[model samples]
Every structure is written in C-alpha cells, then in structure tokens.
Target: MDAVQVVAEPRRREILRLVWDEERSAGEIADRFDVTFGAVSQHLRVLRDAGLVTLRQDGKKRFYRADREALGPLAAYLQSMWADRLDTLAELSEAAERAERGEGTDT
Candidate 1:
C-alpha cells in the first residue's frame, strides 16, 4: 500500500506516533491501546509493508520505529494536521470549561 493509504487509518497514524521517536517493542505499543494485541499486530504489519516503520527482532520480541525518511513529506503534513487538530480540541475544551463556570455565556 502507498504511504498515504497506509496512514489513512487512525490506528496506523497513532502507531506511527508511538514509534516516531524511539524503537518500541510490539508488546509495548500494544499496551498503550485498548484494542487486542492481534489488532495492533495487524497495524504493525501494514506499517511494515508500507515502509513507514522499521522492524527489529530481538529474541522473540519485535521492535518498531517510524521510518521518517520513508514518510518524506507526509511526516510534516501529519505533524501540522495533528497540531491543528490538537489546537482546535484544546480551544473547544477551554470553551466548555468556561461555559460550565458561567464565565463566557452571551446570555
């Protein structure tokens, strides 16, 4: 699958984020999500097939890290997009808090 298609899934994007900075064991990555290990493993496989993540095997454990070089321009795009979303979410949360406190109501 192409990089864009591979990262279109939310879980795959999250998986990329998890391994962006450092290599992590498959089990470690799976622990962060609510889904079953099998699901996470499937995501890992997709990422591997897309060349977006590098895999390293040590003994019986598998480690994964994001291959930023493979992502190329998509890395910057994803970062910008995620940052914008986070900013919007934070604004919404703050507005909700103000509404709860009766501090920003127009009425």
Candidate 2:
C-alpha cells in the first residue's frame, strides 16, 4: 500500500509518531503497545514498505525512524485540511458568540 493508505490505520500512525523524531528498535516500539510483537512487526513492515520510515542496522539491532522529507506531501495535505477545519470552527464559534449576545438573532 502507499504511504497514505498505510498510515490510514491508527496503529500505524501511532507507530510513526513514536519514531518521528528518534530512531527506535522494533522491540522498543512493540513495548509501547498492548498487541503482540508480531503485530507490531507487521505494522513496522508496512511503514517501511510505504517509505514513511527508514530502517538502520546496528550490530544485531534494527532501528526505525520516520523519513521527514518523505512525508512532506502528506504533511502539507494534512496541515491544509487542519487549517480548513479550524477556519470553519472559528466561524461557527463567532456565530455562536453573536447568538449568545443577541446581536444577530432573528427572533
């Protein structure tokens, strides 16, 4: 699956959040979840395949971290969507305030 599709799952997104800033081993990530280690492995596999994360090998350990540059498009899209939603929320809040103050009431 593509990066967008792969991250559509909340669990995978959570995994990304964990590795976003720092490199972590598979075992470290699995420890954060209540699910089985195998399940976490599968999620890690998906993230790796989707190019959303990078894997590095150090001795016997495999570390993972988010590929920030690879997430540019997705991040921009999400930010735009968030901005739009916030704009809508602000408009609604202002209208509600006006109603509360009886400044724009039709009644």
Candidate 3:
C-alpha cells in the first residue's frame, strides 16, 4: 500500500507519531496502546511495507522508527496538520480555563 493509504488509519498515524522521534521496540509500541499485540504488529507491518518506517531486528526483538526521508512531502504535511490541531487544542483549553474563572463572557 502507498504511504497515504497506509497512514490513513488513525492507529497507524499514531504509531508514526510514537516513532517519529526515536526508535522503539515493538513491545514498547504495543504497550502504548490499549489494543492487543497482534493488532499493533499488523500496523507495524503496514508501516514497514509502505516504507514509512525502518525496522531493525536485534536478537528476539524488532525496533521501529519513522523514515522521514521516505515520507518526503507527506512528512511536512503531517507536521503542519499536527501543529494546527495542537494550536486548536491550546485555544480550546485556554477558553475552558477562562470560562472556569468567569472571564470568558462579555458584559
């Protein structure tokens, strides 16, 4: 599957986020989510197949990390989208705090 299709799933996008900064073992990745190990494995497989992630095997464990170079333009797009969402979340949180302090209403 192409990178776009592979990352279309929410779980896959989150997996990418988890590995975006550094390499993580499959078990570590699985532990971050509430799903079964097999489910996380499937997502990893999809990411590996799409060349969106690089996998390394050591002894009995597999580690994964995002291949930002492979993602090319998509990486920038994802970063922009995530930034926008975070900005929106920050705005909403500030608004909630203001409301709690009774300072959000006009007049």
Candidate 4:
C-alpha cells in the first residue's frame, strides 16, 4: 500500500500525527482514540504494512513512531506536484497582469 492508502483512514492518520514527533507506546496511543485497543492495533498493522511506521520493543512494551525514510518519498511526491501547481498559478497570474496592462490576448 502507498502512503495515501496508509493515511486514508482517519484513525490511522491521527495515530501517525501523534507519533510523528516521538515514539509512543501502544496503550498511550490507543488512549487518545475513542475506539478499542484492538481497533487501534488493526490500524497500526495497516500503517506498519505500508512502511509508514516502525515498532521497537522496549522490554515488554512496544513503541511506535513514524518512519522518516518511508515518509520522505511521499513528501517528495507532494512537493513535486505542488510545485507544478504553483507554476501553473504563476503563469495564470502573469497573464492576468498583462491583461490588466492592456496587453490581452486580442492584442
């Protein structure tokens, strides 16, 4: 699954956002959600399968956090697409400016 699919679920997205800054225990993360722990676990499984998160064992507890490397590709893809959109907007803006200056398409 891609990053988009991984983050498509609202609960999963919230989990990722919460864990983005620091590693969080399963219970700690689960507590923030209204759903049951089992439900949250299922969401984490999807995220882990998508390579968006990593789990580390600390004694008997598991700590989860966002995988920076996995998220990097997604970020790059979004940046590239946003840049193209910005370029299109810039071109439209320049055309509008020229039109305002009486250098429209008819001229």
How many residue pairs clash in each candidate at the backbone level?
0, 0, 0, 0
By lDDT rank, best first, the candidates go 1, 3, 2, 4
CA lDDT of each candidate? 0.94, 0.86, 0.93, 0.84
Sort the predicted structures by TM-score, highest score first.
Answer: 3, 1, 2, 4
lDDT of each residue in 1-107, candidate 3, tens digit only: 78899889999999998999999999999999999999999999999998999999999999999999999999998888888989999999988998999894565
Candidate 3 residues lying further than 4 Å off, grouped into runs, are 105-107
Question: Number of the top candidate by lDDT?
Answer: 1
Q: After superposition, how far is residue 3 of candidate 1 from its true place, in Å?
A: 1.0
| Per-residue alpha-carbon lDDT of candidate 1 for residues 39-107, written as tens digits (9 for 90 to 100) | 999999999998999999999999999999999999999888878989999999989999899896565
1-107: candidate 2 lDDT, tens digit per residue: 77789878988878887897699999999999999999999999988888889999999988999887888788666456557878999999988999898787564
Off by over 4 Å in 2: 76-107
Q: lDDT tens string, model 4, 1-107?
A: 78897776778867887787799999999999999999999998898988888999999998999886888766566446557878999999999999899896764
Question: Can you give the TM-score per candidate against the true fold?
Answer: 0.84, 0.69, 0.90, 0.66
TM-score of 4: 0.66
RMSD of 1: 2.1
Model 4: how far is 105 from its true place, Å? 42
Ten residues in a row with the worst lDDT in model 1? 98-107
